[model samples]
Target: MSSFVTPKKWLTVPLEDVILRIVGGGTPSKSKPEYYQGEIPWMSVKDMNKHVLQDTVDHISQAAVDNSSTNVIPAEIPIIATRMGLGKIVIADFDSAINQDLKALFLPTEVHRDYFVYWYRSVAQKIERMGTGTTVKGIRLEVLKGLEFALPPLAEQRVIADKLDTLLAQVENTKARLEHISQILKRFRQSVLAAAVSGRLTEGWRSGDNPERNFKNLGEAGVEVKTGPFGSALHKSDYVNGGIPVINPMHISEGTIKPSESMTISHQKYTSLEAWHLRKGDVVVGRRGEMGRASVVESDEPQLCGTGSMILRVGEDALPKYLEIILRSPTAVSYFNSDSVGSTMVNLNQKIIKNFEVYFPSLSEQTEIVRRIDQLFAHADRTEQQVNNALAHVNNLTQSILAKAFRGELTEQWRKDNPALISEENSAEALLERIKAERAAAKPVKKTRKKAPS
Candidate 1:
């Protein structure tokens, strides 16, 4: 026996030589009542969203499985999410039926199964590139079967597969930890926003024991509140490429007037209606879909408004930043949504928003409050960034680990320690010989049969 640490043996084989059987999944007819309910797991792409989806969310009766063209994939068959998620692969633990488009792969070659799975996972981008159809994108079975891969020798394959499994395990653990941290950070931000709007955030900044209330209704808070007046005149074609971005309900998010994906209103249109150009410090609140969600205009540069959004121009009496925070508070969000009208497309009209009550402290007090909100929000933003960075790092680590595993590096340490697993000859070749022998021994016996209508 050689004492040369890890084995140096390697080989390459075609995927077509090793692929055992490939099957396409099926879906029972939704219209048939008999196919509606059963113990058998009937899975769709949506069913795979759940992290631990061993059993499916829905089931179809055995009769449905029998009547439908969909075949029942046996246990341990690997199913790939070919349509929606594209490359998301899951090993089915129970007998289940899948949507027709989702490809199911069963490894007949036992030793190569793990290695093939790892290799297939490596080409996620290639798999995504094969996106088909104009509507719901999919990778057809013919396309999937034709996928080419560079396969190493059997002993090397085992080494690579083992290493990849360990590295992926670590990456998955890191990802789980980051996900938990993200949830905690999200909750903290939500809590801070809740406290700010509820008047609890500034609890300590009270007036003296006898100091008269240095406060005014929001109308005196140093800003004017005006809505967009050109609601009826807006059109889709009045949009430009670079000038000012148009604001819509989609742009009017919880706390700010984010620019639309599209730009708007060419110079001619703006010149034709100079009064419609928006200024900074203006708050745009949603008028449809999710009514009353508010956002502030971050840019001093020009912008235009759409029919589905209302532009709130702040007057000199109110602090735009302070008012913007208040609008972002949970209380304000709830208030606007509650006061909103309409069933199909909910909206908070200009009249209701203009008449809405707002509370404010004195100018100096307002400045301090805004400063504190800024500090707290900045802190929250940092925490969020940290969680995001951690998550990103975990994702990168996972890809690296997976890449290293397929490269025959991960199992090097293990192979060095357990030299007994290393054989003098190729392991895959021995396994392949055994399979051929079995097939040769099972030759069909010849039998005489009576001739019919000779």
Candidate 2:
């Protein structure tokens, strides 16, 4: 196996040499509910998500520990997953019992705890790739022990760990802030929609005309609601590779129609189901499943609405874009959800769509409202895109930092500045010799059997 190439003063050693002991864990009898009721945290693969695990989802009793192969690992020790969650590592905050999938490593005093943890994290992906099993993949003990470890002097190890701690923590904080911004952008878009449909967004434009804000049912304001074809009307055999696209509920997202080519129908089928043909300026909506999913058709594309959707043809009194915004608003969604039929899957009928009340503004006012809402929404979309890009960069920055730390690039200056720490007596080779001597001294001597019959 290839070994890790370290600096001249550093040493590359087998992982087993640095570790004092490797302890495997086990699960208590799950049949006995009493075994799980105690205060000791029982760690499994699920609890290994965080870098520093404080508590677990389960707890086990002392009786369970005595009855099972599981062992308690003390706080601040490094625990890694050998199965399922292959590459993860965590330090326990309290003394915790581990299930069969985890292994707790006991290191010598000479090895920096944080340094080992960071190094393990750097090679986690490599370890994961070494895992083997038909079902739950796991790394064998031999494979783990045989793995190479790049060792620097103890002092340099500590310095590298300290630098990583500061850098990675800053990266995490920046990511958290970016995530918070993404959430804010979501709320901002929803707020814009809420204001647009409520007539509040167009209040300024309405000042000169003071036209009567008529509240009328959708049908009264001139909108014809038509449901799509039934299942019997469209068959699977009618679908063709290059045919008219079908607009399904899944295709309608964020006020736009994204037709699926695979769900398309042949020209013959489209001609037979001509009543469901989509027209430009028509607002298509999902009639089943999630409510308030809608989009306005902006093109004269030869597309047929799927069985799970409905069409809203707005008259001159209402703009199609404005109607789409109204249907997708929170107020309309709440109404549809409460009034919709079916216990397993909710559905909307033509009557429900036509009877829904809407804030009817003048045709000119509807145009202005749609324009303002679109402008605001576009701005929010751009901001969200930028935030997503930044989040991607921040995520990559973590691995980049870890790679640099392991390559000795992070402590290059410190190594040059403090040559004594990495030279002769304080070198990595000397550290390994010290570890070897300690292990030999700690070995227990076996007692010789005396001659009983003599």
Candidate 3:
């Protein structure tokens, strides 16, 4: 125990001492066609994301629960995900039935539910790490029953919970505002790209400059478009340890080239596929998944276009960077989707890519547009970084608050203000005895089910 928590008033006890019951739930039989689509909310790991669950993705009939191992838990119970999600906890807003992955906790009247929920969150990460399994790691019933935690007097617990609620609400509000700003920034970036590709971005500069405003097809501009090697020309067996990197659609993200995690081809294979070699100015576009996803090859390293991709080598008439920006624009992306082939998975061929039209300007004007876009984008990046840093600090602050809270530091002043809660009537030990007595007295009640008329 930390120096902050004086053991005289704070009693360290096993979870089972304060917990009235721990109920393990089960799933209804999936083979029973009438088992589902009922009024009872059936919760799974996915529905446990929120702090409280008002409804679930699926529901089951009461007959289903009667036929299977599943049981319905009452409202206000805190359900902890024991298996798949591992430590995800949520309180039941309404009566709910859970799958095998969840275990609901029934806390004694002595322990405050909100207080325990916040405390559990602080140790959730540690509990998750202790789990062991080959596929889905989970905590056993013994582990949960044996877990120990320090409990403050009931009044102090309520005060601590109320304080945290006020503080965390402010933090959540700020985070939501930052998230909204991020969404606006995304729309701003798309607007900039849309204007740039439509010849409207440089309308002011065009008044004094003699720029080509005509829209022309890519093939008419002397650009060479080629697809990657297919059929027997390239095989998975040809890949070796390391010779040349293959640029795939996965390797291109956010308009930049990234290192490939896939296999590299041999030097002989590289020589055989010399036509697919990528150059510094070449713009590579995904020819299959996510049509119109393109990236500018800024690296001088030797690389070849991998399968499911296309390469565009621009001549003196056009700038490769400018062409890539056009390809990434909303208009070109829509065109690519419309012209794509294949039923299950739409793909682009060399012909469709070669005939795509784009609004062109003089080389100098293109350079200016690129320069302006870079300037605005850099500012946006800086703002985004600041937002991310602030959000990280907020996350760290939550953990810090929890640590201080569990250490009894949060209510130190409150403890001094309210001294009556330290007495035997309201003390944690007295409360434990009362809970035990209540359970002991309630056990002998016999339920008499009346028989039907004979």
TM-score, predicted candidate 1 vs. hidden true structure: 0.79
Error of 3 at 235 (Å): 4.4
lDDT at residue 387 of model 1 (Cα atoms)? 80
lDDT of 2 by residue, 360-412 (tens): 78888888888888788888889999999999999889888988887789998
Model 3, which residues run further than 4 Å from truth? Answer: 1-8, 235-243, 439-454
- Cα TM-score per model: 0.79, 0.82, 0.90
For each candidate in the order shown, give its overall lDDT on alpha carbons: 0.65, 0.89, 0.82
Number of backbone-clashing residue pairs for each candidate, in the order shown? 16, 0, 0
Worst 10-residue lDDT window, candidate 2: 1-10
Best by lDDT: 2
lDDT of 3 by residue, 1-454 (tens): 4323544678777777777777778888889878897899998899988888779999999898888777798999889988877767899789998888888888877688999998788778777887889888988878877676768899988988898898788888988898888898888877888889888888888877554577888888777888888888778887766668888888787688776545678777898898898988899988888865798898888888988788998889788888888888888888989998989887998788778887777788889889888888899989989998998898888878887888888888888888888667988778778878866664557889999999
Ranking by lDDT: 2, 3, 1
Error of 2 at 68 (Å): 3.9
lDDT of 2 at 353: 84
Q: Where does the lowest 10-residue lDDT sum fall in candidate 1?
A: 2-11
